[model samples]
Target chain A: MKIDKQKFPDTDGFFGEYGGKFVPETLMYALEELEDTYSKLKDSEDFKKEFYADLSDFVGRPSPLYYADRLTKHYKSGKIWLKREDLNHTGAHKINNTVGQILLAKYMGKKRIIAETGAGQHGVATATVAARLGLECHIYMGAEDVKRQSLNVYRIKLLGAHVHAVDSGTATLKDALNEALRDWVTNVDDTYYIIGSVTGPHPYPMIVRDFNSVVGFELIDQSKALFGRMPDAIIACVGGGSNAMGAFYPFIDKKETRLIGVEAGGNGVSTGEHAAPLNDGSPGVLHGARSYLMQDEVGQVKDTKSVSAGLDYPGVGPEHSWLKDIGRAEYVAINDQEALDAFHTVTKLEGIMPALETAHAFAYLDHLPKDFDESTNIIVNVSGRGDKDINTVAEIDGIKF
Target chain B: MNRLRKKLDHLISIKEKALVAYLVAGDPDLDSTLDLMHLFVKSGVDIIEVGVPFTDPIAEGPIIQKAHDRALKNNISLPNIIKLVEDFRKVDDSTPIILMGYLNTFSFHKELIDKSDQHGVDAVLVVDIPGELSISSYGISNPNIDSISLISPTTSQERIEKIAKNGSGFIYYVTLRGVTGSSNLDVEEINSNIKKIRSYSDIPTLAGFGIKSNEDARLLSEYSDGIIVGSSIVDMITKQSESRNFDRIGEYLRGLKNAIL
Candidate 1:
């Protein structure tokens, strides 16, 4: 129950048999340099001050922990509290990590930054930071995503970042990730790979999680101030699980609090179209670390379909896999239709338009037991706003946006 | 040591650089892959690297990526590639065959190492495994199969030493700063790095990536013990698929060999 977050990754950056450096030989040094610099700077007061200053001034930190009274009325059992990361600058919690990494990049003397994104929130956030820092930025996005999320492509370009439409391997997040890695490998000297999630190899999962843990840290303080006690459970949608890791990490040592991760079930888990790796997949090494993945018998990563581009990945963060195996956290799935319904429900009830990805976590409320303790408060991470997803949602709903 | 070591040692004794050739096992077709393997040997390839096709190969450039797509279209899997090596071994067993691929393919086929060794696979070169990581850690290693580790331009000297220590068959010195098939090689930098690698371990170092012409191969062979050509051969196969002038592959490989010698 007592988890020492510092001792984790045990020098090699592993979380139990999960996270390890599974990158090319060319990237080992860059990761090592990052690991060294991050380790030294993370605990420094100066770094914390800068990060907090940015959070307060730029990202609008201390995102409110608002009570979803109507949603709780519909659920009938538990009181639901929403961690409004969707309220942050760039309309998502992704800015938290990008800001931290771009600062680290500047410190490391990296003049160029590269990133890969699925839903475009991370891409937009990364572009925003790179633009603010005046660093050369390149975002690799799948060609299919480029077509579906043209607005985000335009947004990234407008931020002065070049968007490379990747056409390899299903033309989705995984393919874009491969292309980004290729770009990183080719330009390791002057380029900083700003991985948008807590997934990549070693320090990335640790670093991204730490950078975003500001969300949970803020939640802890605000929850005590507003609710008189910590919430009984914390919930977040897990794509590569950056937001979930951010929210759950601060509570890792809080033994009494429950952590639930919701995954995109797509059509349904049985139909094999889901991105619910933790719920229905097996342990395998993917991207750069050992994690739960939607891979076939031969270890070939399977194609995943989800209504939300952010949750359409075949792999989950390595720490989530470790947490799942150790029985420290619970994971469940929400289907696309259920998420859409929740999207509509949250928008109508709370007047808060939830990103389709965040809707998965909101959708989990409908599945909670009716006899569950009414006194226990549940905090769901509304990780992003739905502005970027408006077109996709509109087209699906037969509304021409 | 295995056949790869033996082949390298033989080449060294004869004062010739080992000309290593790489080809995806099921590119174009399985039958063509079979023919290509023999052609590589007859055309003076000291070692033949057979790529097992997978849906995603991150380290590859556009040429090999397309080759993998073509190979996968014909339903090529790890077992079938190992079988292709088995078939290659039937007629000629002297030329070393290194099964090159990603870690997932090797890990998926549970008995890949045993199968590769039993079928006379001389070594294995997994693109993702850096020197610090071990193939044995994933339960993939065999005495019969020398696990080749890669050293890149960005690889620190400390890691180069570490990789050279663990590396078996040979240390593959990626001559370029990027993925496979990428252009731009600083031969002087590669020569110096190879020296650093050789300082740590006596494992024969081979230069690869962007060795397009016979001149490039000959130029690189002077600094390292051997050379490995991937994109050039894969590109030839792709262009010659319509020509079906598969002999051109042999001719090009022979040209690389003659230049190195």
Candidate 2:
């Protein structure tokens, strides 16, 4: 499908009927300030030079696009390649966005940085950038997530960022987000909120998507250098839909490339315990954006369950909602067991441990259309490394360590 | 004119300040909320802002957020709150009741908004969707119920013009740069911003958020037409939930009213 990327999120920051600035009046000035600064800086060559230089020198950009030969053979149907965002600094694709936003904060003369995290990768990434920039940083993580992802919490604290353990409303990503927003509202003047996904109100979804689109842009060059054409399909997991939107943005206009977003099916979609909003949820307003959300009949957001902490969100990005409605991309879900099996399979076969979030995309390979042959080249976004999820995997395996 | 405009006009004509008190409906239960509504009027509160409980109230502080949680625990929905308002109207016909909440809870129950006038709901203050976007943006075609728009300290001069011009009932001037219960209200900043809003439109401005003490209400109402007390009142209700002894609440409201007078 020939989707126009620039046309979306109109001046008021909407994508079709979704993605408006549904925040309190207090944050409007800051959002407008950010939008103005970003508009001038996004096209400035000086800004691009600085941004790309940091990506190359600081974040270790051009993260390798490697072909997973063993995984392809295991699948026995099509060629599989991985966008090795795990190779980036901070060991996740989240740094791409943090690196960009930290620079934005600096440009906007903000001295403090605040972020909300679910799996801790984004928190670690934001902390890493804030440390380098010498900005006061605070990260809000759900109390449950703080306990689950303790290593990342320690790392963030070690990097001089304060971690506020939020214990409200399901005490997960959504709650953490609510706390971060409250903090931002409280300290709007000095604090710049670095939202870690393609969620939240306008400009954020657009900004995060633009920063992370380096993944797809790099893949375009790498694919041509290797396979001489775009991949037949691109797969990435959708939590708040940042990574998937990044991978899919550059290919939206390319008719030949198929975009597939995989969501975490904790138990199953029918069981209503999953985080697959696009697959099983309805359109509603949450977190300042109108999107498909796991909400009840009365519009209260539902608590979502997922083995991957990063994928446990009640809502998807509004752009993904638009893409789904327009039939520009396909969204599917993979259960916890299937994602776990895929994690183990890829680690054994390819000698690479993918993040639980990324494993969802890899798990979808088993459910691919039967018509795909050996010539078909599929690229999956390996969003992060699995070191943070080692304890989760161990607990499930009944290992004390 | 609607009941809200009439009440505010009457207050302005008499050179009296409006004391608007906010309480989450069904915090302890719906019957207590009704009793509290009558108490607010009896204690000389000029207007009552009934908080419609929502799951995630991002604009609220811990006190109001906890109140929402307590209300939701009792399965409090928007329709139930509207019904509560209907029940309130059966006894008190003149006092203007405004439903304040997040956008989704009210937007999802558009049918109630359409009939809000019949149920004696004079206004709705949706915290999330402000300015150019109103309840009509969500497909609620009700012309009777006033849409109260908020103007914060951070609002630009240009936006003040837009919001002030578009808003009805009154301009909700967020006194501080924070959530409901945040402190450190810059009186000078609030005064200047309220003046700027008045320069744009003739709507009555009500300063809310962070107005805790009667002194705070007295000082803020000196600049604007009225003052709205939210988190502080909600906090009192939560603390008094066990005792059901709301005389203290009534005392606080009376103090605020007298201070503003």
Candidate 3:
């Protein structure tokens, strides 16, 4: 299983079992040509200048680290701050990775940016980047997800991406993933699979983290600017574990900032009603890499149920799994009802209607101790705006206000 | 000899092609599964592949999916599969029985696969797992049970060599690139792959995936050592089960006995 991980270059872009330049015997010459070009182009001053310039002006340079004073007041403890990724373009932290992948895609001379989305957030983010870059975009969505998340369907299409409704198998996220994989296998020549999360093969997690690490990069500066020091802890929600990874990566080197990952505890983790795979699962390989997974006793992956459609999954990102195993970060679960309660709590008490997915971190208040200090600045990644989830939440339970 | 080893070895020594039969365990009902299994062995089946239905069967065609849904609706559990195997052992013990399904369904039923030597199930064929990965590595820790692998016509010769070297019981060479039950095969490609497999290793190659009609089975029988028919037989039983003709399905299976032998 680890053999495949060994195929790639020793963190320098090798592909064999670690990773291969083994794209296709046909494209071998083209890829070799591209790699040679990339070596010279990668660290060129113009490349960095254009990339960082676009990131700040267009993609929203520095997402704020706003002190969530209300959460602190309610908990009657440590001061809480929210890294407002919700304020970024395309509504989630997905753009951070999408922006970088698109730039990398452009540098590779790839014409089409194809992606797979679960809750449709990543697809929209990728499509937004594709449109801005004047590249063709394709989004693969399971037919069932298309029906459930029709609004996201509209959002992706409005961004000018073609959505292929994956009707095979369970007609959900996994099927969408298979279709995306099929597309990659078929169109490897001209297409770049802009995976939304820090999952899929290799280079993806490493590169996506590099793009997303911007959050952690900004958090340190934001934390220092406001409190004259880095926060004691950083928290974020994990679907495929990208947003949490982005918020946690830079701080991984800084041992003081304890990292907490909140997975969607759908109905409940004990009830097997959540997508808290890392918390409840054991080590296994899926989508070409070893990671913690929600496999049945047969060791076959099982369907995970989470209140947040976004976090409902059977696997975790490889890096997140590694982090959990190494004890650098703690992966925890917050179930459907608890996330919903947190959603309402944050909305009413803090006037911020969090995405049902993001409310998982808010639900951590149940587990965290009540006493904290002003110096113990806690940063929670508000990964997305909740407008898209409002209607889905209303469909679940009726509310007057 | 082990049940799987005996079946393949028996056929190899006899200079006769093996006829491997397949059925979804607990389809329609558990009782019917037992009756169908017995009927399968009686009708010249050298070995049986008991399909353990799963929630997501990406490798299955429409026919098998329906059987899986019916089996799941009947509340078939992993224990039921073992119970079926145990019950089958009460009458007959010579015919090898291989438990075939997805890895999820198999992993949950590992205790059963572990006790397969005791229960008389000789091997397990998890349809979804590619040969590049091992059964034990995937958490199916039992060393006693043989892990059957499927090699498609689409699979490269190098891959065939790898699967053949590792595969025990028999090599299930899927006749088509598409899922089971789909028709219109390349008989030439089928024979070439089998010939290719023969060149690589001595593992007995069993052709399946689209072998439905007797003519189709008879045709594939010429190239491969064994034939496996799944969806067609399961579909026939399910169609008859709708009219409450459970016995008629068994009778119908009798008609296809010539297809295998």
The runs of at least 3 residues in candidate 1 whose Cα sits more than 4 Å from the true structure, single-residue gaps closed, are: none
Superposition error at A175 for model 1 (Å): 0.7
The order of the candidates by lDDT, greatest first, is: 2, 1, 3
Candidate 1 docking band: medium
- Give the Cα error of residue A128 in candidate 3, in Å: 5.1
Worst 10 residues of 3 chain A by lDDT: A18-27
Error of 3 at B92 (Å): 3.0
lDDT of 3 by residue, A176-287 (tens): 7756765654455687778788775555666677678888889988888999987888888998889998888877777778899998887787887668888888765455
Per-residue lDDT tens digits for candidate 1, residues A297-363, read 7777889989889999999999999889988889999999999999999999999999999999999
Q: Would you estimate the TM-scores of all the predictions?
A: 0.98, 0.99, 0.77
Q: Highest TM-score, which number? A: 2
Q: After superposition, how far is residue A99 of candidate 3 from its true place, in Å?
A: 5.7
Give candidate 1's error at residue B27 in angstroms.
1.1
Instruction: Give candidate 2's TM-score.
Output: 0.99
lDDT comparing candidate 3 with the true structure = 0.75
Backbone clashes per model, in order?
0, 0, 23
Better of 1 and 3 by DockQ: 1
